[model samples]
Target: MSPLLRSPLAGSGPDLCYPLLLNTSCRLSLGPRFSASLLYILTFSLALLTVLLNLLLIVSISHFRQLHTPTNMVLLSLAGSDLLIGLVVMPLGAQYYISSCWFLGPWLCSAFYMLSYVLTSASVASILLISLDRYLAVCQPLRYASEVTMGRVQLAVGLCWSCAVVYNGGLLGVNMRGPPRRTSCQGECVVVVDGSSDWLDFLVTFLAPISTVVALYLQVFAAALSQARKMRSSWAAAAVGAAAAARRSELKAARRLGVVVVVFLLCYFPSLGFMGEDVSVNSAASFWSTFLLHLNSCLNPLLYALFYPWFRWTIRLIVTLQILKPNSSRATVLH
Candidate 1:
């Protein structure tokens, strides 16, 4: 929920965002003071958990030589965005919800929203790449490695981040150009967008990438089902040693990552469902939708821990500091 005040509860606060601003200030907006405190603690705890989990994922992927493949490269990229969401967005979001106030004030508020948009776009891009990689690996195993090389994956990640930055910068250009309108209550960083911009963002950031990801994963799922019934299916490509083994591995990864993609779509669809509607930020739908989106930032690492044996093993090694020993980067993670 936005740190914005509803008219009914406008009179309930001795605790205000900016007490010094008096009449103009937004109030710290929850029903009971104790509930607000509990909520803050809960939200912050989740954010911290998100940071730690994603950090582990980042360290595991970055520090391990054996983990450095096109698939892991894309994973590493996704983890980076997730880490930032935990580090930056989640805390800010928590404050926005608990206190219902933009404590950072005017310009930082715009930057904060812009950062969120960039991360959101970048995350969708990362998922799209992952889905594409899985599609190729499952649907066309013979061409997977050649098409999704490390160099190409890295280039794609760079391009995705760069484009996200540019796209969101332009998307929130009105706020980027100047402070939020003064008519807003103090401590409120309300960003009002025209219907045109709303539709544009919905299409670009939500519809297009999400649709592509779903479509690709559909193919991946189909190929997986076919391969499941027949190990010697055309999609799995019978070959000796590494080639065949690699195909099997790729097929497994596709299934695991499919879970990740499904969760992404589920979290996103609600949050972006009413893009054109000027919904009250304080509404239950608004609150739950925003909560779910932030919750998604933490879900991926949890999914990795649950699905990937390599990830669980690496976490143990890293936690035990076994990774500090000589030639540790060469240690086997994938079982």
Candidate 2:
């Protein structure tokens, strides 16, 4: 067998990641060759899937003018972040997982972690904003149009991304300054925030947003239920029926978005548990938790495809290249 094709674990002389840099290289600690290869394939495939699916969402929402509603504007922002996670963050993560070392050097490592933090915070903030949007639409139906205008939603989306950058930048400033503070040995790229900072991150990014989502969704569902009951008992008038249909449509939208939010939380929650502990990046617990969180990006568009008719129609249009024609952006996607 060729030397290059030989198993990484076979005939190992400590299995240095960079054989040339004996003093500075990291030692490989992976398992069997087949298992490692399988893991690499799985992670890379997931990363690719995340990128493609979220890209479809971005194109569908951005190209179609009929989809340029206040709520879809928020979704567009979310797709942007998810696409970045797939494009930038997941590939780096897969590299780390396969090599079990950080050969990218300290500066790039810091930049990578900073970008990851910002994107994650942005995603969480987007979910929060979505919850708020649904709450207002379902609970304050009369005022929703005036309050959650497209311009206002656009501003809110901008604020979400901006705050994520500023907040996580401040939170992770210490690690970003000078040399990387987390690594103890060469070829190691770990992010170790202090206990206080971890707790603070947990509170601000996870706890607070989760609390708000739960509370708001509860109110939204309650209001929707009451409104539904009212509609069912109302007179059989034409105006009333039209209003009831609109309300039903809004209720369905809220339910679909609620599933997305819940799945996002479920995928993200495990990472919080792992964060409280001192697990290494290469550990099984860490890999699974991180993988689950990243998998949420892939799951989101699938949910939209399942529950959202507009999304299905848009996907069909996008897939067939029908959207390439002139004035296609103005095409009606929603029934």
Candidate 3:
């Protein structure tokens, strides 16, 4: 018997397949729950859409040689991490969310949980790396090529995955295996940290990453400001206008990265805050709070679709050609 199973909030996990709404506090059974049904639909749709978008991104990135660079290699790693969460973790989560209990065996349950944690952590780290890359390119253009070489980028990616595995794995040890727990049906389910480790989890997982990202961007912004000041001093010079324009573009790129940082915090922080509150931590809010976290899996694809112009254009080109392609009727018409 696990700690969660013995807790007062034992029925807190959203029952995905059972289709019954029982208030964790009141035990008032609401007839035929729709929340689980909605969650199921949302989880399935988001995961499927992400898979398609990531696959298209992979193919497009592969086919276009010009898109192959150290920076893109980091992007590719981020896409890969998103794809892992969408494909591997989302299905299990959807099943658990819908069923209300983890039907998957203990090994698989642990594996899925671990996989989601690792991939998500890696995704955050990768975003941090991307910010650093953009910073170097804009702030230190002359040395950027030599500094952010392919070998160094690959090492950074390797470090990202390694850190993700170790850090999140530690949490998995605490959450999944640390305490024994059972589901509403009295079977082995995931261990829920009702109150303990909540702040620690928030700091290590979300706050630390966010702080690092912000710090990197701050350095980038400062560097850009310095360049702008230099350009202003040389305003009468022939190349000053070009230099200013280039600096402005770099600032714009930094702003784009700032958007990424903002989105990540927005999508993740609510859940952290919800978990932070004692009352909410053990309520339906805890179960429903994960929806925001799950939304993180779907964000990368949307971000790329919206921000990466080349990727968008490539997708459009492929769609247009596919739509315009003639079927068997074209052969008959020619004859």
Candidate 4:
């Protein structure tokens, strides 16, 4: 949904805060054969897949006791945020995409759009916090135990949620009333990312958080290497020093985190780049690129399972149980 076209419906008269809707309607007038059905199918399928995988991810993590840690709790919160996004935002976005219009009434439309933005913001913030936490653990392991407390994590999550609420909700108050028009037609409201708001969103949503993540990961990697060197120096003093093993694990974790950083950077920055430009030549490019940005949330659990051994073990246990479903009862009876 480019801001250029205010509304899909043409000849729509403005109601109370209806100018935006009319503008959207006017912009939505179609030209050629865009397969709404196919788009709906893909959109629905992605939404369903994202929901199912994220649900399984959350359930698996919750059920596995070994997976419980302050770090995993942050991941759990991330999963919850992504789950909300998949459940609430994706399907509705798909509907709007297919219909090329917002028929879901004005209030509902505004609320849905706002919620999508809020959840997305929260998810991004949570990811940044996770990176920060991991950096602390690897770089400052001794201090990490004290600093990254469960209470602190809870506070971080709360702050992320509050920031998302204020930022996204604030948009609702800054209404984007459309041009004065006389014709009456179906209407809806969408966030207007014009000159200032667009840059503001890019700064808050992508730039600042990305910078935080990059800096944290950089420090974490340097710290991990430093720790590794320190551990190697003491290898001769103690037989079977677990410090070396711990350093190895920390290095591996840092590498996995590097993947996350790369994914976040690759997925998100381009869209911001496009949006920040003056000319809207690549609006479709921006849309698809931003869509892929959301897809990052769905991809992370799988990446964790693949790259982190502990996560892999948890995933293996969950999958084994799922595969042995029919024999689960038999195993229970034998026990």
Candidate 5:
């Protein structure tokens, strides 16, 4: 029996999850049942929305020949990671949030934590790749086409996912051994990485990538401003307007993607705060931080729909099943 299971008032108030195994089973969550149910419903709905939106992005990018650019490939990779988070991580998180127990056993718990870490790290890596892509497109226009090939982008995305898996394995390898090492009680599934490991993971997965994004975006903005000024002053009156329009479009895309990166950083930074110490996954603060991180998946596609007219257009086609039509992949999305 664990200390949590040995509470003096444990069985006196509510029913144990497993009445027969009183000493080992978790106590039912203490709260108004209706409120808990409502929360669960909302969480599950958000998870579903996240999945659907990211799925739309995945399909739109993957199916459209026009969207087969390196930049779109990065977005595709991002949508894939977000899809996994929504489909797998969020549902499992909801179960823990609602039931407040680990009924699924130790191996499943280890696998859940491992998957969560991999997807999250992959998301961060994908954002970094997006920022780099935009930086080159906006700041290094002359070399962008030559440097950022589809093959290179695909290789980078593959490496990002592979590194995520390898990095998390190194960080959480001990915890993945079995229940005896990770869980203090039978009914609880807790992942406890040491403070050192937590800090290292934070630095590698969160801090370093975020810093790179910020730096890259700053350079991008500066270059865009300079380019706008040059276009205004240097080009002939007839050509200036058209050239400026094209440049402005590129700048706008960078700005929109910048918003996505900023939102990602905002949602992700809170989790870093909780990772400083040996944090329990079941803590209230941990739960909220994790919720915010998962909420990023929901917000990402919404950001695309809001900023990218093409996303809205493609979404309409997708929802209406127009994408199933012949040669729909050849449909022009961007004008």
Candidate 6:
């Protein structure tokens, strides 16, 4: 009966989700069969790409000692979460989007939702950590070396992940206790967040992080400009030439990181327009909004490859299988 259902086109009496169960099965929601197949193939392709790219990022950061630093550690965290998104969330989501049926039982369905939520939360935290790292590096360069050390950054990454797991677990706890929320029938699995969880998700995942990141980037760019001025002014000054060069390097790094943040904002900002009293996600707008958010994960590694020469070098090394050679981790990827 729904607009999404393809019972009329399929020429079957009705396309039940579980065709064997006449009394309990839900109707399949889909478009024309050819279009649906093409869409599924595209979605699966995206999932595969996302997985492969993020995996490369993870390996690049984890394997190369030169790539190990406070900033790269946060990137590692982001890549780790993105890898999970591509690995777990995207496949499950693709299946649901194409088939409009939940073959996995209620518990696994809830687990899927929770896992997706946690991984996304971790990505947000990692982005926030990145913002903070750049902020300190640019705005308070004097303290950056001491304050943003590897151990501290590692702990922060750990907290970012552990806290996401615990936080999202509590956020979805209420739904887990009760029966899974069905969209229309027995074969449907969806999370229908009530007023409170919706607001919490909006705030923690969207509002608070967005506000913090925007504020930090604003300051970072402002400071980077000041540093640029200092670099230009002190380039000829023998006493501060070293300082100017350092500041210039930091400025370049900040600009690269800024590109990452700006891309994330562009991808994520559309979702801000999505919140309202209507919680249904059965519309084109909802699907694209979510797809854009997931697309951010895929775009990130590409950005790194574009902005960071080290990333491209590592990719070449990784692709050529040179990483298997002894002490290849010590090979110069960064100039």
What is the per-residue lDDT of model 4 for residues 1-335, given as tens digits with 9 covering 90 to 100? Answer: 12221222222223323346544342343223365455556667777777876777787667655555677777887888878767877777655543435666666766776777787788788779878877877877778877788788878888888988898777545643432122234543344455677677777887788789888888887876676566675655265467657756666766786786688667766555556454234434544665676677678777876776655554555667752465432221111
TM-score-better candidate, 2 vs 3 = 2
lDDT of each: 0.79, 0.78, 0.64, 0.63, 0.79, 0.78
> How many clashes (backbone atoms < 3 Å, residues ≥3 apart in a chain or on different chains) does model 5 have?
0
**Pairs of colliding residues, candidate 5:** none
Under the 3 Å rule for N, CA and C atoms, how many clashes does model 3 have?
Answer: 8
Model 2 per-residue lDDT tens digits across residues 1-335: 00001112222337777778788776765667687788778878988999988899999898988888998988888888888888987878767765666678878877788888888888888899999999888888889977889899999999988888888888878535676675555766766676677778888888899899999999989988787677665464345877778777888889999999999989987777655445553366666777788888888888888988888898899889999999999998888
Write down the TM-score of every candidate. Answer: 0.90, 0.92, 0.76, 0.77, 0.91, 0.92
- On residues 1-335, what C-alpha lDDT tens digit does candidate 5 reach at each position? 00011111122346666678867777766356686677688889999999999999999998889989998999999999899989988887777765666678878877888888898889999999999999988877778879899999999999999999988887789544555364544666666676677777778987788889899999999988787677666545356777567667778889999999999989877776665565553366666777888999999999999999999999999999999999999999987
lDDT of 6 by residue, 1-335 (tens): 00111121222236888878888887776767797787778778888999999999999999999999999999999998888888887777767766667789778877888888898888888889999999898788889987899999999999888999898888788646765654556677767666666777788887898799989989988987665565565435456777766877887888898888888878877665645444353356556666777888899999998999999889999999999999998988888
Number of colliding residue pairs in each model: 1, 0, 8, 13, 0, 0
Give candidates' CA RMSD values in order. Answer: 3.1, 5.2, 7.5, 6.2, 3.9, 3.6
Model 6 CA lDDT for position 195: 64
Candidate 3 lDDT trough over 10 residues, lowest sum: 1-10
Q: Please identify model 2 stretches exceeding 4 Å from their true place.
A: 1-13, 234-239
